[model samples]
Target: MNFWYVPWFILPYLLLAFILVKQHKKSNRSNLFFKFIYWSFFYLFIYLGITEIQDKSYFFTIPVLFFVLFSWMYHREKARVLNGFLLNLFIASFGIYLLYNFLITQDVLVFALIFLVGVFVVLVGLFGFVGLMILFYWNALVVIKRESHSLANLLTLILAVVMTIWLIYDSFIAKMLPDWASILLSILPMMFFYFVFAFLNFLSASLLYQFNQPSYDQDFIIVLGAGLVQGTKVSPLLANRIHKAIDFYYQQRKYTRHWVKFIMSGGQGPDEKTAEAIAMKDYALQQGIPEDDILIETNSTTTLENMQYSKEIIDRADIKAPKVIFSSNNYHIFRAGIFARMAQLKAEGIGAKTAFYYLPNAFLREFIAIIAMKRKLHFTIISLLASVLLLLSIIAHFVS
Candidate 1:
């Protein structure tokens, strides 16, 4: 056996990759399926090449290299903010990580084949499962005690306690239970896998969203609103958003002759002394942003409304094809971009820095919110999967 004429097929693969990338750039979100197809073929090509090359490193390096390549492409293409490209990137990265662990630990190969639960254990590493669980519990408690009593923030505490109970039951108590009882309880693991898959993807996408840096050619810096401190003052959290916009404003002017206008988007809450947008404007004014340059939209009660109302203002401002950026806290940007897309606003979001400890808790809430957006579709899939598992369990139960 010898190597020859590999170029005949290899050239077409390269050509297909080019066409897919070009189509994705042209159609953006609507072209997401092309990305999925591209990655599927990409992995297949890698596996097939390994047979010819007889090199195991191709399995590891090729996936990681493609992940980096697409990740760089994702960061550069600000046009498609909420598309499947990011999800594909995460899939490539996760698969590469699992493969790396298998190649290294050898004995770990079996576990890595079983999906994230096994990889989760792999991550536990020298710390061990018990040690990792204890660390999770400690962080959960810290979040619950320090954060507000909102249900969103309390999810960490609830998850920590629930996982602890489930593990205890599965590890020890399940051995003594009747076969059918245990069979029925297997549904929990099924659901656990489903949710863990979702949560991990969300975490990956949220983490990747931060790498987006919009160009200085923007015409509008739309600052999304947050809750006011004591209903009357701009909190540090809100100021961070304003400052991100202001920094971009100055940077745009410094780099080019173009000037950008700020759109302060927020409405009055019941406890607020004034509209949040007005309060944000006051803060920007104090920071030396000209009152004339800032446009206030004080009617948005939610993030979607913020995008919709701001789009209206931009449309009426008589700007042709206005390039815009929306600024919010880092965790909030991904979800807000979803809203921006829904509102048919052609703009990319730019997130500002927020506190570290607050990120995980905030991210949990954002993940839930994004899930809720496609609730009917997601609920149907979850129900279908759960039903399949439950049906299997029932068959075992009846046979027993």
Candidate 2:
């Protein structure tokens, strides 16, 4: 409405929208700043609207809700591949918080809600984060007992041990240590905080990637492979992926009348009788998928290779601007998308269902992988934090 608001709130939001739409049109789905920029503008514009309220009509909610509406509309428009689901979670919680404060002003009934919440908090505090930690350790034990002893499966176990050790040290041992020694050891949790941030980002990105789907008219469904059963048959895990690809292939063909190819991608392991891709293709065929529609890339042993080798096959197909999607288990889809981008493949992933009990450990493993993917950035921030902490300690010594 005013000239000042136009520049401060309107212009920047419109500019962000334009950049996102432009990047979206070009299929540049890798910009990690989109969510941050969008949400920043979202809260800013809302706060601005609240400040400038002049008994405006309901339509004034347009500017107040502009960024929220924009997020809802554009989120499914292939722009959500950038991740940050935690931002969405934050939006909901913030909205509820604001709504609660507003309604508390209206009636005494709201006080009952607050009182109930306080009571619930008190009850739950009896078995709070410590209880949560106990569950985490138990889950880790279950993962180790039921799954392989591989490093991936051992993630929960390792994390549990680290957390328990830190809890004991921070709770009991820190009091007896020398002041400087205690101060330095305090950096352990500070360092852990950085990794915790990375884990949250990874978790958010994984949820966002899985929720944002590809169009039904994709040209190919590249099924990323896993290991086989006893070196011959498609393991249930691998079969879940193939089943997902087939389901998508069938649904797309049925609804859109667009026949998509399946690129079964994987290689034989040291103990396998044949390539994982071959076994995947065999399973797909048994499910009544046409053999002509299934293509196999049998040389990929890792997810990275799956993307790279599959891209090579896709390039050889000689189609101009072909649309493609890959199929894998839900937890694996996010990382597979990263690998696809790394391989320069313009594709989205269609995630298959993962079991409930399996998700926590699988997500932890994926979180670790994502953290490893950006070791340099983490190391730099960590080093900077260490220097800051040491400087603060030195200053505190002199000040004291």
For each candidate in the order shown, give its overall lDDT on alpha carbons.
0.75, 0.73
Give the candidate number with the greatest lDDT: 1
Please provide, for model 1 over 1-400, each residue's C-alpha lDDT reduced to its tens digit, 9 standing for 90 to 100. 1234345555776687777777655333323554655575565445444442453344445555665666565555433323344556656565655555444434232243546655665776867656646766776777777777788777666766777888899899999987777777777877776777777767766666666666678889899998999898998999999998898788778767588899999999998989999999999999999998999999999999999999999999898899989999988988887788789887777778987767767887887887787788778987888787678778878897
Off by over 4 Å in 1: 1-124, 127-132
Best by TM-score: 2
Query: Candidate 1: lDDT over CA atoms?
Result: 0.75
Estimate the TM-score of every prediction. 0.75, 0.76
RMSD of each: 8.3, 8.8
Give the per-residue lDDT digits (tens) of candidate 2, residues 21-41.
665553323333555465665
User: What lDDT is reached at residue 163 by model 1?
Assistant: 78
